[model samples]
Target: MEFGVSTFITDEGIGAADLGRALEERDFDALFIAEHTHIPASRETPYPGGGELPRIYYRTLDPFVALTAVAAVTERLVVATGIALVIERDPITTAKEVASLDLISGGRMVFGVGAGWNREEMRNHGTDPATRGALMDERIRAMREIWTAETAEFHGEYVDFDPIYAWPKPVQQPHPPIYVGGESERAIARVAEYGGGWLPRGNVENLGDLVAKVRDRAGWRVPVTVYAARRDPAVIESYAAAGVDRTLFFLPTQPRDETLRTLDEFTELAKRHT
Candidate 1:
């Protein structure tokens, strides 16, 4: 099982290029950052992790831009979005962004995506929360078409386009892996139907059975990657037993040395299992 770190990557935190080089130097497997295009002033959606939502959520740097900076400095570290809001972006433009990043990073992008939670935030982007899932699905399907075809065309409720030539195909064959996030049944189905892997938010429930069910239903053995945000080595082993392929440890702060210390500690702890 590979070990990685998930950080906020906000404007105040360690810069992307610095963090990327640090993670690589530490021998970490990957570095991931979460996304929120912009947080609304309204506080309707309570943070899943509790307490006041940290500044990082509102202060996050754009994932693609940040990842690009990281990619420029690192040779082997996997740079990824812990979760990109697919419901609020254009599929064609995003496809091009993913392809360009993959080429720049030598195919080391993991396109983690989610429908998002804040209704007001989605509304700001002109996306209705009621249809976020459907929109997300269509956007992903359209992205796949763009990445895999020389001249791609797609027609769906949320994404429709005529055949057009898109250039700089991703370095990884068929494009970098698209990992779907969230725990809903629909989320699992979406991953099985279109994604390269299942990215489950860390929770107490045993997802082994659900993972098996999704794979069986899809007829494709997609790997499961656990967020493992606060889980210990024992818990990680349990996830491995449950067939998890990779685990990401969450770090919500920005202090470079402090975060790096945590990474070193987790790296040592994770080495026991590897």
Candidate 2:
């Protein structure tokens, strides 16, 4: 299985382009960056990781824009949104951004997405917290039309648009791979339906069973990619043996030298896996 780094690239860390080049240089297969438009100062949503929200969450660069830089500088690395908050953005505009990034990167974009956990943040974007799952589903469905059709339109409970022309359809036919990121059964079903792949976090329980279930439903059409996978070789090996297509280990947010030092360690882990 291929191995890579998944990170939150921020204003204070090693720049995205530099980090991307470093990953490619070390033979890492992909670079998956995280996203957060803005964190609400008054947010009551507990951090999913279960503690005070990390400073990185507030300092992240826009995933799409940072990835554009990453793509411009690296030739072979796959540039992706580790999990873009589709529930917090307009589908039409976001579609163009994804397609544009795909074109710019010569078809090497993976659209990893989720309905995020921050209720205040979602509200700030004019999205209702209660119905975000449906909103995310429809937005993704709508984006598919934008990427594929010359004149596309979609009418759904959450997304409604008339036929419109959007330039620069993605270089990858039908668009870049959409790796739905979550651990729920609904997420697994979504993969069977329209997802190009799956991006469940590596800590998920009963991962082997989930992998088997997804494969049974969609055959090889939906490959499983485990993100933020443990750095341990044994852990990564377990994922590979369970039929994971790729494992992206977490990279700590740090400046150039510190980041590179940690990357060297992860690179060694990748060497064993790759």
Query: What value does the lDDT take at residue 48 in candidate 1?
Result: 77
Report clash pairs, candidate 1: none
Expressed as tens digits, the lDDT of each residue in 133-175 for candidate 1 is: 9898889889889999999999887788999999778999878
Question: What are the root-mean-square deviations of the candidates from the true structure over C-alphas?
Answer: 1.4, 1.0
* lDDT (tens digit, per residue) of candidate 2 on 162-241: 99998779999878999989878788788887789899998987888888888777666477789999877778778977
Worst 10 residues of 1 by lDDT: 225-234
Model 2 alpha-carbon miss at residue 228, Å: 0.7
- Model 2 lDDT on a 0 to 1 scale: 0.90
Give model 1's TM-score versus the native structure. 0.95
Question: TM-scores, in order shown?
Answer: 0.95, 0.98
